[model samples]
Target: MFISGVHHIQLTAPPGCEPDARAFYIGLLGLDEIPKPRSLQDRGGVWFRTGNCDLHISPRENDTPPGTNWHVALRVKNAEALRRKLQEAGARIDPAPEIPGWKRFFGYDPFGNKLEFLEIA
Candidate 1:
């Protein structure tokens, strides 16, 4: 089998916590919010667009699992700068070691989902 590219990556958010999700995803992460279709509007959640990739968060009946191992790694321009911003916002940042060619770290989203951001080092 052959695959071209990723369409989107989704993570679960706690129910009725869109405000926290927005604050972390849009406000801190710098990802622009995307409008959901009419069909999915009432379901409760949010979507964001980052250049060519789309990130979707859906409401879950339970809380998101907290972990540093399982996560979504995003390629970025300046990982250090973003890491600082995250620290300033009272977000949890993990001291992840250097990845071969990348400056990397881990930060947990509002719903406790782990996210990895890296830039070419």
Candidate 2:
């Protein structure tokens, strides 16, 4: 019971998809890219800072397939605005069912990773 909080969430992308990954996670999502360790730089991946939690995207030989239920939930301040922005950018967004005191939606990264954005009402 020594755990305090999540330090990071790791996701995987297809090999050689760094540019697209940067665009989706950094440009579209507004996450700031952070420097990875010098030794791991050659592995071909990117790290991003989101509030106190860090998101790590690693390049893998096999990419994730669609229709998977696995997803990462991120708390946000403006889910509506973000949904609009993502829709405008042609990203696939799935509306979530009503939650009593929450606004939420589902989005996918360029690599087909599922992400959830939620705001408390």
Candidate 3:
């Protein structure tokens, strides 16, 4: 039981898509951008601070298959409001089934990465 909690989650983005990634993760999602180390700066990726954890987006070709269920579940304050916001912003929203003690939904980022938003009930 050495692992305590997650420090960061890394996801891939298509090469040369830093602007698009920043637009979505920072402009749309409102995540605070963090500076990357000098050694990694030239790698072409962005890092974000989300609550207690960090999210790293590396520049690479994403080969995820269609309909893949892989996703990062992010805890949110108001799932309904965020769902509407994402919907209004032209992001795809997928309704999720009722789960005990949780209100949740799935949405896709600009990179086609599935993200689950949940609010504890």
Candidate 4:
């Protein structure tokens, strides 16, 4: 009865992918990386912040490949520009998006995590 919006969305990354995650989430997506607490930093993961949302990336227990349709949709100011940035970074981008109410597209990070970006109309 008292649940607020999501405090954070935690996604799994394979071990030792911080550089790749950093490149995609920060270098490409433009989210600002945050420092994990000293107690948790040794666990091997990364954190990011955008507005009020905190994104936490941890090591996957199974370390399997990412699947289609399982992705995080981020509201962006200019989705097209981000898509172009992804292309230039050599990240795998899905075909042109066809969703309503948003100019959007999907892209995968170097470690094969799915991410979606959309600009709400």
Candidate 5:
């Protein structure tokens, strides 16, 4: 099987919550917002870009299932600062920043989507 790199990852959020999603991902985590194609705006969503990875958020028609392990991970220059920014923005820190070969930490978005950051060494 020949497979190229990941094209993009799409995550579902409860309907009409794009603003909050934007606040958390863009306002808090500091990921750059990518403009979605005009054709997709009516569907209600937002896009974020970090290096080659794209994170797409779409409105969920139904409740997100329990125990779903979907998430997006980002690599940053300083995991501790990122974690601090997230904490200051009122995000719940799941795993506090730690240095185990790589400085890292984990947190959840407004809708409980898992997010992690790792410092690039």
Candidate 6:
């Protein structure tokens, strides 16, 4: 099968955690909160947009284990500035050093979801 590119990334969060998830993705990270289609609103989740791609959060029946490696990577113009912004917002920065030529850093959301910011060389 041929894949054009990533359409969107879906994250699973414990039920009733949508508000906190929205706060982090919107308030802290500054991603635009987009309305999910009426058809999907009953699914109890939220959607965020950054450029062309989408990030979705859906309700999960069980909690994900700590240290889970699942994450979504986003590209930014300045990794350092973004990292500082996140740090100032009280997000914990993962110790994974930035890979040269692909400036990037790891961070966790309010719900413990891993997020990566990368700056192209």
* Candidate that scores best on TM-score: 2
Candidate 5, residue 7: the lDDT equals 75
Q: Each model's TM-score?
A: 0.91, 0.93, 0.92, 0.88, 0.84, 0.85
RMSD (Cα, Å) for all candidates, in order, is 1.5, 1.4, 1.5, 1.8, 2.4, 2.0
Give the local distance difference test score of model 1: 0.86
| Order of models, best lDDT first | 2, 3, 1, 6, 4, 5
Per-candidate count of clashing residue pairs (backbone under 3 Å):
0, 0, 0, 0, 0, 0
- Residue-wise C-alpha lDDT for candidate 2, range 1-121, written one tens digit per residue: 9999999999999888789888998888899999999999999989999999999989988667546678999998888999999899989999888899999999988888899999998
lDDT (0 to 1) per candidate: 0.86, 0.90, 0.88, 0.83, 0.79, 0.83
Tens digit of lDDT per residue, candidate 6, span 3-120? 8888788887888988888778887778999899999898898999988899988888877834657678888888888788889989989765757789888988877889888888
Error of 5 at 88 (Å): 1.4
Q: What does candidate 5's lDDT look like per residue over 22-71, in tens digits? A: 88878877778999998889988888986788899888877573463555
Residues 1-121 of candidate 1 have per-residue lDDT tens digits of: 6988888888998788788888988888888999999999999999999778899999989665745478888888888899999999999999887669888998888777888888888
**Clash number for model 1?**
0
Clashing pairs in 2: none
RMSD of 2: 1.4
Q: Top model by lDDT, which number?
A: 2
**Candidate 4 per-residue lDDT over residues 4-63, each given as its tens digit:** 887888888888878988887887778899999999988998999977889998987778
Name the lDDT value of residue 109 in candidate 5: 81
